[model samples]
Target: MGGPSENPELWAFLESLHLGETLSGTITAIERFGVFVALDDGPNHPVFPGVGFISIPELSWRRFEAASDVVQVGQRVSCEFLQLDTWNLEARLSLRATQPDPFQAFADRNAVGQKLRGHVTKLVPFGVFVQVANGIEGLIHLQELTWTPLKAPSDVVQVGDEVTVVVTQIDRELRRLVLSRRQASPDHL
Candidate 1:
């Protein structure tokens, strides 16, 4: 009954929202790709059920098998404005932006050659990605997986394995963390 169509003042207010604005809302809907929030004291969206929207990756810093792990319908949340999607004509918001960046946090607390332990999250042909912290993942390149020449990362460790590693590089601009498992264990060689 109440929406941008019904309230011109709300439409104008929503349209006036600038980038980087913080807004509070109730999660009205959840989709596989994103979450929709009906902003408090705001008008309904012209197309979406809510005026504020958050994409899957923007849901949280930590990886989860399901969106419900990050947010649920009817939950209250605050999000940072990302952009004004001209195509969909909706506000692209980032829920994660409101939260701390685990990647940056890890880097600030760690450095190259520092030893750390983490769980193997994913194993690719090139390397294995390890979860160094809540949402921070570091890659152990195939060459760094072992001191000896290895065929693949899987040969050294499987996914879900807990492994010790040394930080090799931290590219904050690119948000990348390179790690070395071989350097972490010299006695094993």
Candidate 2:
């Protein structure tokens, strides 16, 4: 037995066990639960086999309403293995997990005044969740969502809409990412 990281060949072999490792594979089957990825790893690999599963929560690095929208049968994707159980032969992988944080890049790219494109993920009475990039979610508070007088934030934007936003604040210590749609779009006012 070899440590997962130590054994390059074994690591590569184990990585091929899941969907995200290598996108080159056929969708051997699809079921109500999830799609299956057929790899050249072994013979007789079951379609929806074993305890290994990529739950909806683990599917994306960012928050999404529907899992199916992000993935489908016969789609190729590269992913990073989060965990694996040799005993149970279970593997947990993530497509975005393997990628670097966009917010970090945002912070690096712009000091403060830079603009970014963000998609609405959640709408609340107080604010909205905007995905600036994969694994990077910024909050657009009711006050920040719009400059106009609004009774509710949802009036300005609905979930899944892409809007331009300005980086108002980035609190890495508190893990807070703040953006202002109002500032980003002055014409909207």
Candidate 3:
């Protein structure tokens, strides 16, 4: 776990790797935390089932219920080499890197003030999440929910309700979309 710099052989192996490099491997194990992969030409993990490790968030950009929803044992996969986990003596890989980011795609095709029709997916104290595009959910903050002040998003909309919204702000770097329902309403205009 602590020998990458201390161990010359491991250091050389790590140096040979280039970030963002594509690596092919077979999924060896899937646990609650992550998935392990035996890279076709990678080094031994020493303690783990495989030398490559993929954290749950790195598995995909889309929201999923479980790791099994995205991958399975013995499944072959191609992932981008993220970095070496010196603490675990394993290479961190990212399956999401192998796929196009839906957030980025959504931002590219849309702009602020653009009106979009989406279904309310979730409600919270602060805001509501609406699926504005495939795999893209934007937050409509409490203040943006209606022209009239409301204590909670539930007062304005509930999950499964179809609503029209206007893109008020888009944070590309943060992968966030701020929406406003009041602005999109014909009565408000």
Candidate 4:
């Protein structure tokens, strides 16, 4: 065990580990594995001084489909440390874990009956996956794609097509967002 004053560098790092410490760092690189960031200079380097790994679950605001989506070769980001494995020299950082869930933000902005515009990302026999936001996705079921009976969602909407939709239900517990394009344009029904 290291005493605080005896090791100023270690002491500073431990002090900064206190809950709610906000850190800003520059993304040094974005690999298929995860994003690497170098802590802004002071005492603690955002990159963990001598350590080299920052877990993928920490990037803020968006759920990265892949590491590249959330960060590029060079980007600046503010993150909160979730945990540090000093023994292994690993630090877990998070952008989403520290902030309020953005789904709640969407739910707050739009109600069950509110209309929204989204782009269709995929078409399945069961429904279409529309990307409402980078991390947020809403499902438009085949039945909800249109008021009229349809055998497939592709018949009504194709991938990359933008369409208006109405939120029919939001399952916050399950993080499921249910939307209906038919309800928004009932006249077309």
Q: Mind giving the per-residue lDDT tens digits that candidate 1 earns over 1-189?
A: 355556576557657988899989999999998999898867776668887779998998777887888898999999998886644556788999998887788889998989999999998999999998878889988888887988887777888999999999999888899999989987774
Backbone clashes for every candidate come to: 0, 1, 0, 5
lDDT, residue 31, candidate 1: 92
Per-candidate TM-scores read 0.86, 0.54, 0.90, 0.68
The parts of candidate 2 lying over 4 Å away from their true place are 1-36, 43-47, 50-52, 86-88, 98-100, 113-122, 130-137, 143-151, 154-166, 171-176, 181-189
Q: Give the winner by lDDT.
A: 3
Please give the CA lDDT of all the candidate structures: 0.85, 0.64, 0.89, 0.71
The digit string of per-residue lDDT tens for model 4 on 1-189 reads: 344544567446644664556667777767665666666643443333322245676665554578776666567777776676555444456766667888878777777888888999889889998888666889998998887899988777899999888989998887789999888888966
lDDT of 2 by residue, 82-162 (tens): 566553344555556666665567566665666999799888888999988767888888888777777887787889898
Score candidate 1 by lDDT.
Answer: 0.85
Candidate 2 residue 135 C-alpha distance from true site, Å: 8.6
Q: Total clashes, candidate 1?
A: 0
Error of 4 at 50 (Å): 5.8
Residue pairs in clash, model 2: 20-79
TM-score of model 2 vs. true structure: 0.54
- For candidate 2, the C-alpha RMSD (Å) to the true structure equals 7.1
Candidate numbers sorted by TM-score from highest down: 3, 1, 4, 2
State the RMSD for candidate 4. 4.7
Candidates' RMSD to native: 3.1, 7.1, 2.3, 4.7
Which residue pairs in candidate 4 collide?
A: 39-46, 39-47, 58-94, 58-95, 60-95
Screening candidate 1 with a backbone cut-off below 3 angstroms (N, C-alpha, C), the clashing residue pairs are: none
